[model samples]
Target: MINRRDALRASGLATFGALALGAVDAGLTPAEATASGQLRGWTPLPDPAAGGVTSPPFPKNLTAEERRNLKTFDELDFTVFSSADWARLDESHAKHVRVHWPDGHYTDGIQKHIDDLAALFVWAPDTNIQVHPLRVAKGNLTAVTGVMRGTFSAPMPDGKGGYIEPTGRQYAINMATVGLWNRRGTMDEEFLFWDNQTFYSQIGL
Candidate 1:
């Protein structure tokens, strides 16, 4: 029988795909659109740091540093998210739950799905946002992936043309590489996570 978890997985993937198409339509290149695809699924790729290989260009006003990040990790594994970002992700989960034969925890709102994982994934509500990491599954042998929501294109603060706007591009990265989960299985080791932050300004917002 198709279980609740399976239903949720299918719904999340479909919804996230649709959301990704919407993002590309908003202004992302085919590559930017596919960046989210990498989160849900991974294939061996040519190194992103390779030369003459930039993703679709962003608005032309971001700072040298911001632009670099936009190119390097923008489409890298999405395992990063912020506090508000994660809360908003719950909104997506809530919506998909109804369509996917959700469990009582979702439909009845009894679960209060918000937690530190979700919270850390949200944007910092400031120009600079922290990219927090979370494991989608314990001891996952393969990979876990998901899509962050969409964001509007705005000029960046560093004299760039695009800003990594909050309330948008909320992250949806699941464990992809076995590297994160294999060695650590206990809660005590969770402290090993690294905190990476991305800062930017809105150019045209």
Candidate 2:
């Protein structure tokens, strides 16, 4: 004795239940499955420890300035970008810092830079960046290259104050940043470069 709307609702719920069970079997939580979609045909890689492979230690023999810059960069990446700890912004940037992106847009103050970075999480809450193998520091400049990876699992803000719907697509794009640290041991300027076209294509935008 179900009406058409009731029958449709029941069918949708049954389908969702099946998908959730499948996601659980694939080692994903229900929430992850809801955000990341059904990861069909995906398999987790074997553990590296099983093959006697271990990660190497951090680089050594850096000058005092180089080491300090590296530490600051690591703090900025792990604390601010990856962990979303916005309060640590001052730890890496000066009060009047300027951040320039590849798109010719720039943020003037430390707070504005922090706000720009924070907005990314509104679109992709799980965004993370990892620097690998290419850290270099000399004098007042520090440069690092890494991959920024995230899933577009939330609405994105459009310029007109409306939001575009979530795409549920994940992306990993290579990016590089160069920072100029002042005598105060905080970056006074930073330049960031990344490919916007590749990002857009990967996110299905």
Off by over 4 Å in 2: 1-61
TM-score of each: 0.22, 0.70
Residue-level lDDT tens digits of model 2 in 90-193:
98899999887867677899889888988999999999875433455555666565667899999999979999999999988766676778888998878776
Native-referenced Cα lDDT, model 2: 0.69
TM-score of candidate 2 to 2 decimals: 0.70
Give the Cα-based TM-score of candidate 1 against the true structure: 0.22
Model 1 Cα shift for residue 41 (angstroms): 20
Give the Cα lDDT of each candidate: 0.28, 0.69
In Å, residue 160's CA in model 1 sits off its true spot by 55
Each candidate: RMSD: 18.5, 20.0
Winning model by TM-score? 2
